[model samples]
Target chain A: MKLKDIIAALDAEVVSAEDLEKEISGGYCGDFLSFVMAQAPAGCAWFTVMSNHNVAAVAALTEVGVTILCEGVEPDEQLKAKAVGRGLDLIVTAKPVFEAVKALDL
Target chain B: MSSLHLEFDVAGNNFVSAGSASDEVKKTLKMLGVDPVAVRKVAIAMYEGEINMVIHAGGGKASVDIDTDKVKIVLADEGPGIPDISLAMKDGYSTAPDAIRDLGFGAGMGLPNMKKYTDEMHIDSTVGVGTTVTMVVNLR
Candidate 1:
């Protein structure tokens, strides 16, 4: 599925890279970085409220297809730029973390 | 066999920088044509160890040696060491403070998960001096 679908499905806002909605995949959710590193499959949509540059780094390392920031938390401009430069689809959702994950049908 | 060695200094209490070492190791392994599964295993195992070093041990050093037969990781920290290795190895056993938990870590799975992902694991630690973890993931 395209990233646009994920945004539409979850009623999320496109926080960055409004032009790159073509990149999307299955959803994976976890707050624990270690657990996500271990279990989050490569090339999948990742949903978390982790609001740090490290989240973008993890997405780069894990090759996550996209990142959905839940709970309406907005990352700083640096992180947003990093996400865009890394070609990651970044979105923001006002819904709770679990609800965002559920909307993805993961 | 000539080994590829990589070293990283993990910063104390820096959750944002925790995975930097693992990320570099993963990239190096991938460039060297290590098996993808083995790379992932080593990445996860070493990443967890790095996080533990930051959270519990006040940061430390991580050294990884990659050879034809195995990838070896050594993480050494100078914080308060584990009093009971076996107890600490159990799942859901954590001594990390609640503050670390708010960052989505300190779940007590660091040691257990490290052991789970590596083929061989050894931990040497003193209560006050420091802790050293050595793990080997065989490359078949």
Candidate 2:
């Protein structure tokens, strides 16, 4: 599924828009950075409440299609700027991690 | 392609620019047409090392030597060395303080993850002096 479609389905807010047409292969949820880096599949949509700037680095390294900040979490200014600079997508949603993931049809 | 070497100074406690070095190396590997799988391994392993440097060693020096067959990474830091490397290598063991945990790290997966993605790994450290980690990822 394309990122934009997932965003629409989840009612997510795009804070740092990259390639909305990018296809998300799947989803991985985690707050631990190294675990996410080691375990996440490339091009998957990452769901996390980690709003720090390191999230941007992990997403870029893992090549995640988009980052879905769940449970009303939002990226801080530094994180937002870093994601934008790296061409990584960042979106926010009020849904909890499980709910946000369940809403995905991909 | 000729062998290429890259080096970067990781500033300690600088969360803002923690992964910049690994990102640069990832982009360079991609541009060099390295295999996607190898690139991912190198990126993850190196990024983990970079974060470790920032968190544990109060910043460190990272150097990468990329040859046709493999990539060699060396991370050296002058922070208080590990007392028990075996313990440190444990999957869920970490010495990071609570502040680092709040930033979403300190789960004790950094070293294990680095070892997981690399073909060979070695560590040399002195308790009060420093620590150096060497890792290699084969491209073939």
Candidate 3:
């Protein structure tokens, strides 16, 4: 799915507008950064409640299609700046974790 | 064979920049045209060490060397050293506080996962002094 499509599906806010057109293969839901680092696949959308600079760092390493912050989670200005530096796309959502997992797959 | 060497200073308790060094190393490996599979392995192993340095040790030094056939990482820290390397190596062992866990780490997977992804692993630690870990991931 395209990132924009997923954003619309989840009613998410675009935290990183540069990535609206990117392609995503699927989705992964995990709160643990280490677990996601070890297990997240390339080109997948990572759904998390984490709001930190390290999240962007992890997204860059995994090459995830996008990072969706669910449960109204928002990345602070610092992480937003870091995401810009790292070229990581982030989206904010009010949906619960289950909604994203049920609506997306890899 | 030719090689590249890089070093980073990991600040103890600085979670915001925990994996910056590993991220840089990943980019370097990619630019050098290392195999994608090998690069990912090195990234994971090195990133784990970076987190360990921040959470466990006060902060330390990380050195990475990528030669023709392998990537080697050395992490040294002056925090309270591991009293028992054997026990810490256990899959489900962890000493990180609840605060660290709240940030999505402290899962007891740091050293074990690092060892899992590397071709070679070594640890030297003193309870009163500190700890140093060396890991190598081969390209062949």
TM-score of each: 0.85, 0.97, 0.92
Candidate 1 residue A25 C-alpha distance from true site, Å: 4.9
Q: Note the Cα lDDT for every prediction shown.
A: 0.82, 0.91, 0.86
- TM-score, model 2 to reference: 0.97
Judge candidate 3 at residue B83 and give its lDDT: 94
Instruction: Pull out the clashing pairs in model 3.
Output: A26-A106, B12-B58
Against the native complex, each candidate's DockQ, computed on alpha carbons, is: 0.43, 0.84, 0.60
Each candidate's interface RMSD, rounded to one decimal? 2.3, 0.8, 1.5
- Top candidate when judged by DockQ against the true structure: 2
Candidates' chain B TM-scores in the order shown:
0.97, 0.98, 0.97
Q: By summed lDDT, which 10 consecutive residues of candidate 1 chain A come out lowest?
A: A16-25
After superposing candidate 3 on the true structure, give the runs of residues whose Cα lies further than 4 Å from its correct spot: A17-19
> Can you write out model 3's per-residue Cα lDDT over B1-140, one digit (the tens) per residue?
58889999999898887888998899899999999888888888888998898998889999999999899999999999999999998876899999888878887878888998899999999998999999999997
Instruction: Kindly report which residue pairs in candidate 1 clash with one another.
Output: none
DockQ-better candidate, 2 vs 3: 2
lDDT string, candidate 3, A2-43, tens digits = 788888888888878576777888668898887887678888
Q: Evaluate model 3 with DockQ and give the value.
A: 0.60
